[model samples]
Target: MNQTYTIKEKTKQIFVLLIPILITQLGMFSMVFFNTIMSGKYNSSDLAGVAIGSSIWSPIFNGISGILLAVSPIAAQRFGEKKSNEVSAVVRHGIYLSVFIALAVIILGFFFLNPILNKMALPARVEKTAFDYLVGLSFGLLPLFIFNVLRSFIYALGKTRVVMVIMLMSLPVNFFLNYAFIFGKFGLPELGGAGAGFATSITYWIIMGMTWFIVKTQDPFSSYPVFANMREFSWEKCKEILQIGVPMGLSTFFETSMFAVVTILLSKYSVTTIAAYQSALNIVSFLYMIPISISTALTVLVGYEVGARHYKDAKQYSWLGVLLAILIATGTGVLVVIFRYQVAGLYSNETAVINLTANFLIFALFFQISDAIQATAQAALRGYKDVNLAFIMTLIAYWLICLPVGYLLAHFAGLGARGYWLGLTIGLLAAGIALSIRLIYIQKRKFTHIQVKEVV
Candidate 1:
């Protein structure tokens, strides 16, 4: 008789798998928070610039990042099949494609920057500042591209801890760069929003360099193929990456663009409101890193299990990941509700900013459960290589359901900023339900078919 792996062993493996990812997420989120705080301190307008600027570019980068998802599955499938050289080829192709994608975005972004900003209807100052920030931020695009390739490679090797280490190294460097540029500390000239942009650009290169170094030195299990001179790029592999990646990228872009659209709408309000909204958002965004980590881990595990033909285990691992995400999100929600004021105070000293941020933070707490559920489910879907479905679900939830409700609540109902928060809640709730149902149906069907075959 064959022995079955115990539940404890499974749980332990999943936890161990997730821990490194969680640490990496936290470290990266901390760097983001540092930038936000630095911008806010320089001026509220600067903070708004970061928000708007990031919104404009995030979607494009997200689409590129989506392509990297192909690496994990392709690498994992090959790893499972014991096709070692093919795994290296996949990673090599992923890096080459990422560089091309990044360069394309950079070139196009420069040409499109003015038009996009104009369409956004940003205030004169905010628009100009954001334009400069984005253009300067564009310098880091190549680095971001390289980092994604290397990071995905690390993830495929299951040495996610390296990601944690690299991010850890980046935190201090990011802070020091922000400090130097923001305040002209240590003889650095004050660059304001432009300074922030330059600081971030430097940080991106540092991260990429460090991650690449790790790939070369520390990780002996990597499949970095030698295609530098002799190998021609494969359109077939590129097409496969695009098929999975384009949808995933569009999903992130759509969701992020929704927030950006709302931010533009909010710009019609006082700058104080935008500042408050950004602060609250920054805090919530940090908390969200937890679920994002779980999702990343789920994607890896689900892909591995599916490739290995462990139908039951795939279903089990995916659900367990969701459960774990919910528990973490719930605990975070409770803590946020309890210390909403203190958390707000950390970002700004203004009474109005603090009050408005605290209120939104309360609303943010209400949606944490659904947020966790949806994020984990989406990750599981990605793991299943069902990227297109995930894209559609996000579209319907945000564009059809959330945006409409938020507009109605904010404009028609006079909820102001509160209306936007309420709208976000509705959208997240819809996404959570839809994604969960999708996962459950897929799991049940797969499991039933497996059981039926066993009986036969």
Candidate 2:
């Protein structure tokens, strides 16, 4: 009876955390959904421009956010250990690091953006709009990184609902600004595709502001004093975060950059092909919120259990999170297969783009399954603080397997855009399998250590 109750209780806890994180994930992606939708409506060139811009931005932005996500597991474990002061300290240093990293991204790094697009030999207007969109996106980089830090801190506290609500609230604001700036409505300039980037920047700042205010004023959050009596810069804390974060960030960057590079490579194809790729990629990305959110929740839950020294519970949470993610992906995959055409139409009225994307949705179905397994598995590993090896595995999957195979297939095999999607599928499957094995090893090693201690 107690075992049954515990399973039920853990399932309930996962769902409770999962739902808000899911909605919050949806809300975050909806902003981009709006961006793609609005840009596609303007024209194919505009859409392609925005697509390239987003392709460049998404992977790097996510990489940095992944780094900042160190806050989630670290803060979660601290919270589980009831070290509130330590939690406060983590948040402080996190904010400092976020600032430094944001500046690096804005100034020193990502120089690839300019030269790569220039070498692509895109139409002048498309190239110009891509740069404009990136310029606008740069404005929000600082705030967005800080907001991610705060969001991780909040999630670690099991206040997933709070971030969900804030993200949901930002949607309409994002939509209105997107509309205004895209079409010259409400005194906003018609910057064409560039407007989408500007809208995203403004929306990010607004959401960040909103989150900052709530964290400052809210009850449980207010008690932590994230900003109060801030300690001097601590290299130890920053290095600890970097040790975990740099590898975690690279893993995600490797995965996302696979897609980014694929898109860039596809740019030489007809505008319709690249545009269709983005259309298909967009809907699947929106659906991706499910597994990714589950992954986020698992990181927090597993981190908490590990910190509390509930080794068995941590293992249970890992498997449960992966199971829930796969089950949800299965259901959604069926629906995507059913409504692929209709969903494709939502991106653009172009018949060619819609038809190509409909066919691509079949491959995207496979993406959900592999991504569900791999993403949650990776998150669980993060909970174990076992990130470096996991990073190497993904590097092998994405760089060695996915990228080379994709380039060869697309160029040599005449598979075009479809080739890259196939490569992604293989890479994700390999990653899922490898990460699962890693998790099993970590679980057994921990249990063995525990048993040895008991024997002693």
Candidate 3:
């Protein structure tokens, strides 16, 4: 009966955290949704242009943000140990790291963006628009990283609802800006597809400002004091963060870049294929927030338990998170398969794009489950501060296994877009199985140690 009660309590707590985080995730994606829709209305080429530009930038941005996410688990552990001062110092280091990474991205963009695009050998029009879009989008890189740091801090403290409200409030503002700038409404310049980039950059600053204001002014976060000793620099602390975070960043880069590579590969075909691919990919990414949110909350919860030395509870959290993610993914997958046509139509009215997107959803249905499981399991590992092995496993699964198979099937076998997606499904399945096995192994090893220590 107590075990049943504990499960029920944990489920309720998970939902409480998961719902807000899910909404925040969706709200953040709404900006992309608006961008895709607005650009699609302008033209398919414009939509494809924005898609290409986003593909280029997202991995860079998300990769660095993933590195900074080290703050959450680390801070959560410290917070669980009631080390408020150390939490603040760790967050300061996160901010410093974010600044360093933001500069690195800007430098890489200036040196590499053009050469990379040139190498892609895209059509002249698509190439020009995508280049412009990325140029406009680059302005937001710093603010986006800063916002992520603030978000990681708040989330680790379990004040997720604050970030959720801020993100939700930004959606309408983002949409209006996207609409005005893209169409040149109210005397704004008609920047076409590139305008979405400008709008997004501006909205990011607003969200960052709001997040900062909340952290500074709110009661829930007041005790933690993020700004205390704001000027202090700690190379040792930075190295500690990088030790764990770099692997995570690389792992995320490998996974996201796989999709980006697929996008670039698809570009060799036709605009319709890329558009259809982007549309289907966008839907799956949006629905993926459900599991991703749960994974994130589980990270904090498990990290806290681990820090408090409640290893059994941490193990329970890991398995429970995986179970919940699979359940949610199953339901979401069924819904997408059922309404695949309508979902595709929502992105665009083009018959070719819609039909292709609907077909892609079939593959999406299978992989969504795998994606959820892998995501949750990885998050749990991060909570345990066992990040390096997960990164190695991801590298093997995505780069060594998935990408090679995907390329062969898509190019050599001539399966085209469908074949690439099938490769993605296989890769995700491999990663999911591998990570689950790792999690169980770690849990059992720890459990055995605990049992023997008790006997001793």
Q: How do all models score by TM-score?
A: 0.87, 0.89, 0.89
Tens digit of lDDT per residue, candidate 2, span 1-456? 011127788888888888999888778777877988898898788888988788778888889888999999998889877898888889888999999998887875357678888887899989988988888888888889999999999998888999989898889998999899888898878988899888989988998899999888997888898988765778898888889899999888887877777877888999999889988887888788889988998999888877767777889889999999999998998899899899899988999999999989998899779989999999999988889999999899888888888778878899878888888888888989999999999999765444111332
Q: Per-residue lDDT for 60 in model 2?
A: 85
Comparing 1 and 2 by TM-score, which wins? 2
Residue 113: error of model 3 in Å?
2.1
Off by over 4 Å in 3: 1-5, 40-48, 122-128, 186-188, 266-279, 341-359, 407-417, 446-456
Global Cα lDDT for candidate 3: 0.86
lDDT of 2: 0.86
TM-score of 2: 0.89
Tens digits of per-residue lDDT for model 1, 87-132: 6767777777878887887888768889988987878877877887
Which candidate comes out best when scored by lDDT?
2
Q: Any residue pairs clashing in model 1, and if so which?
A: none
- Give the clash count for each candidate: 0, 0, 0
- Which segments of model 2 are wrong by more than 4 Å? 1-5, 39-46, 109-116, 185-190, 265-277, 338-359, 406-419, 447-456
lDDT of each: 0.78, 0.86, 0.86
